[model samples]
Target: MSRTLVSALVYVLANGVGLLVASLVLGDSFTFTFKGFFVATLLLSVVEAVAGPAITKAAEDNVPALKGGIALIITFVGLLVTNFLVGGMHIAGISTWLIATLLVWIGALIAQIVLPRIPVKKAVQKARGKQPGKEG
Candidate 1:
């Protein structure tokens, strides 16, 4: 597999894990059926991959003060877009949208940080004919 494919897979896996963790943590307010979860995960991954950079750039240029908070904004927008575009996912019952946004942001942040440290990446590298212990 090419490096691009491996990178994309890693990103999708990270986002999927993030979404799963968020759903588990938030419980009823954020829920997804089995099919819904997969659909939502795919949609979220696409949205983040395509729109994330542009959104981050816009935020940096227009709202410098929001630099740190932009990730949360992007995550919230991604969730909303995924929910709107995919019928399987549902986000509801929150008194404020901030709670939902924060949950997703935190979950994604944790996943992105933690997933790379897991053996999954080593497995992927091994599958690609690369030695796990060697750094490129």
Candidate 2:
């Protein structure tokens, strides 16, 4: 499958397993599925922030803001399934997740700008059908 599809599947599986475990361990009062979704988004953001530049550089291209937005939507829905597995839904604490996302974004931007050269080179080579760690 495509890399994006694989990532989506991983995200869904991670959240689903988390929710199932949470439900079994926590009771009704543990109803914080929304929080999980938000947190998961932030988690994905952090992953993107770190791996994004590499992936972009490997391909020497950006997927466009629209593509990123669609990825976000897919991530959100995947988490939704996780929340369903956990229990119901309760978004009593969304601000925390937002804050975390912002922090992750800042970090991602910094890393991408500072250490982008290597990734860019790798992306370019990869795009040309060259192996990453071998002389062509």
Candidate 3:
């Protein structure tokens, strides 16, 4: 597939996993129906794709000191926007909101680091198999 498609898939999967972690960790305070999980993931992905760059740019320009934490803020904003825009996913309690944001942000960061490795490993294995003196 194209690079853009692969990137998009990665983002969706990462967000889905992140949201799953949040729901599981925050239990009563964060709830999602099966369908709501997928809906929320897609909504979050869209929101991040559309708004993330702009937000990051504004932050970079206005407060360079926030560069490191801008991603966390963006992720939190995505959750808030998704919560307001989508149905079935419910978030309650101030503490839960904060925890959910941190959980999703950390989950996505983990996914970003780990998910791409699988394909890369496969490609490396295939390349090794094609080496000149290699036997099948």
**Predictions in order: lDDT:** 0.79, 0.46, 0.89
Which is better, 2 or 3, measured by TM-score? 3
* Poorest lDDT segment (10 consecutive residues) of candidate 1: 93-102
What digit string (tens of lDDT, one per residue) describes model 3 on residues 1-136? 9988988999899998899889889888999888888899999999988989998999999999999998888998999999997788899988988999999999988997788888887788787776443555
Per-residue accuracy of model 1 over 10-106 as CA lDDT, tens digit each: 7777778878777887788778889988888888888877888998899889988989887787877888899898887778864535676776667
Residue 73 alpha-carbon offset, candidate 2, angstroms: 20
* Regions more than 4 Å wrong, model 2: 32-87, 91-136
lDDT of 3 at 127: 79
Query: By TM-score, highest first, what's the ranking?
Result: 3, 1, 2
TM-score of structure candidate 1: 0.78
lDDT of 2 by residue, 18-61 (tens): 44343344445234555654555445444544554555454435
- The TM-scores of all predictions, comma-separated, are 0.78, 0.27, 0.88
TM-score of decoy 3: 0.88
lDDT, model 1: 0.79
Q: Model 3: how far is 2 from its true place, Å?
A: 0.8
